[model samples]
Target: MKPRLLLTLATVLGFSAGTVQADTIGDPVRGEQLFKRDCAACHQLGEGAVNRVGPQLNGVFDRRAGSLASFSYSKGMSRMGADGLTWTLETLDAYLANPRSLVSGTRMSYRGMKEQQDRSALMAYLRTWSDKPQNIPEASPTARPTVPELDPKILAIQGDPAYGEYLSSECTTCHQRDGSDQGIPAITRWPQDDFVAAMHAYKQKLRPHPVMQMMASRLTDEEIASLAAYFAALD
Candidate 1:
């Protein structure tokens, strides 16, 4: 065969292989379990839930972020939608792993799922719900607001020490006094960022413990920061 023809054939074959690999990388049954445990609180399965804490996730597989009606999305989400971002399995997987990092300033208070398997399962489950075709709205012709650049300074510890003590009282129920609790993980001496990330994980349903999720969900980001700083300051 001519060298030029061989190179063309190799490129076509490589592209075909990549397409096949992309199609074969998810498990729906595992995804379903992950979804029920993690996402069911805010999102309904088969259709039409019209905006709860998070927007309805049905048919979210290929949908743009802020296109749903009646849902009050955060400025971050709306900006992403206007930027023409689509949700493919890969994108969904990354987003579910960590919403804030993937798209800074997203209002979905949930932290990213920590485990790779859990993220993959969640993606699979989401794909099943998205089997139907969806018609996404066009982005408005006018410019949308920009997502604020993340300020690392906002993550600094600057709260009333007494309030930190008060917040720690609730956490000790599971986290324990010395940070040693049977059947529950310890949090003493963990880094400030790690502690905040964990609380975010619980709030986001990325780490599935019902009581923890409920408790974490009720805390504002400011409260989460306070609690995290308090715990990090502990010996």
Candidate 2:
């Protein structure tokens, strides 16, 4: 094949692969169910949809935050738009998980959907309503332009397991140390980094577990790192 033709073929294949990956990650049917259950009260979609508690969501993807002329927006959302924030699948997932955390001082109050599968489904369903749905590949081998920002405080902390062990007693009451699978998950044997990330997610209200969000809210970054270290070290 000629070099230009080969290049064209490669581009076409790559685009086809990305589209397939995006379509498969979330089931639109399930996503619609979750939307009605969790988000229908506040938002709407399609032509002639009206904004309620939240803005109408038609043409949401790739649009700047607070860009819509028809609805009232929160100060933080307007600031984000001023800072050049646009909605994409990755951004949408983060916002869906925790609206206030993604954009500090957002007016939206709902805690977030914890089930990743549900979020994926909701995202797929939402794509159909958008004027332009961005199709980001699932776990793309290529680097993404957008990365979720991490809290500097948490990133700076060097964890101490000894200190963490002392702090972990409170966590054990609910999360449980025993290996048995029950209502709550077993908390021990986590990797240090994953544990830290999960704790920070809770603290930042990204995880949407009400009690954990409240509990993590009071913890300092050092404390979270320490607790992560302690839990991670145990069997």
Candidate 3:
């Protein structure tokens, strides 16, 4: 095979494997649980749920920020609304990651939700009340941290296969013992480079699925490499 052709094939395969494991939606049940624990004090979800510290959020979807008729909005928020910014899944994800970063002096005092999975679940829960929930945006192929960039460095580190074997138990719950595709795809016997790339894609949010993002985020590079080594040897 030509050198250029091999490189192209590798790149395509790397991204294809990563994209296959991508997840976009989250468990709404988990979302509701997170909301009740984290946001219930300030925001209300049900129709009869009235505004507490923050305004009632029944119609927040696609509604301009700070434009709620009955509630008093901060100067920053009002300015944002006047500028025609509406709440969509994308906007909400950004805002929830860091409110002050998005809008400089918002009255909401709670610190932003830092976890991507948590934000995704919260968004799902919030959408239940929205008349028109924004659809999950398609993940672009060029998002970032491609296989060529991230794969080699992690693979360079020596990984402990025994520890990885211990870690593989939880994975077996979704990925079958026989490594057969049963709705969810199997992760066994993946090439080390491809596995590293896929995990990085999830951790970097290049791939969708907040749950996978969260799971990937929790794993260190060494751990990922270890798992890769373990799975590669499994075949």
Candidate 4:
């Protein structure tokens, strides 16, 4: 494809793209597997669920962040609840991606889930417990998973690594070149499409990180692709 055409396509996709939504819940069985692998140790759900290390997630959807009267929550989580952080599909996805990013002093130590599919499945599983028509009130349609899938054409862009290297100085300030994560998550060696999609999310303010949003807001589609290329090739 011509360079001009590629740029045009990127611009068109970058601005107009939105998350994919489905009318029905994702696979709860798969979600249950993920939960068992990652969350079950700390939390309990479904019938006979009770507070474990983490609060029981029976009615998690639409609930305040730390509003369970029986649970002792971190001050930061409680503050987030007081500040009106409700658990909806959007907010839940953000929190699952990176808990610390949303609630700085939260006690949940698990690193966030990176795969959008996995998060959506988990959200679906959680939603099943929260929104049973036979038991609870009808759930809002907006509570469905809002997972975004990048356009294949946009992902096909081949960025200039040299330009990416030049632009990467800003990124290296927070993301270490050596791939070691201190407080922030590691960005090195991520898949090119994942990097691009994440930057776009930050640019759109969907990821909810102020610094990332500010940084991504200044990046063009090509610049983002360049950065993704550069980072993916990094050690």
lDDT of the candidates, in the order given: 0.70, 0.78, 0.77, 0.84
Give a tens-digit lDDT track for model 3, residues 1-235: 2545655886886654345543444567898999889888898887697878998878576788998888888999999999987887778888889898988899988788999889888887777777642343332111112222344455467778887888777678778757899798888888888998999899889999877796787677778888888888896
lDDT for residue 11 in candidate 3, whole number 0-100:
85
Mind giving the per-residue lDDT tens digits that candidate 1 earns over 134-227?
A: 3433311111122222245444546444676798888887678687769888888778778788888998899998888978877666577787
Clashing residue pairs, candidate 2? none
Deviation from native of the Cα of residue 214 in model 3, angstroms? 30
lDDT at 73, model 3: 88
lDDT of 3: 0.77
Model 4 lowest lDDT segment of ten: 140-149
Candidate 4 residues lying further than 4 Å off, grouped into runs, are 1-25, 133-138, 142-235
Could you say which candidate leads in lDDT? 4
lDDT per residue (tens digit) for residues 1-235 in model 2: 2545654786887654345321254787999999899988899976788899999887677789999998889999999999998887788889999888899989888899988889888887777776532364332222123223335644576888898888888887887876455898877888888877888899789999998987777677778889888887787
- Model 3 alpha-carbon drift over 4 Å, by segment: 1-24, 132-235
TM-score of each: 0.45, 0.48, 0.48, 0.51
lDDT of 4 by residue, 59-158 (tens): 8987989999999999999999999999988899899999999998999999999998898889888888886555554553434433434455655668
lDDT of 4 at 35: 97
Error of 1 at 102 (Å): 1.5
Residue 4 displacement (Å), model 4:
22
- By TM-score: ranked, best first: 4, 3, 2, 1
Candidate 4 — number of clashing residue pairs?
0
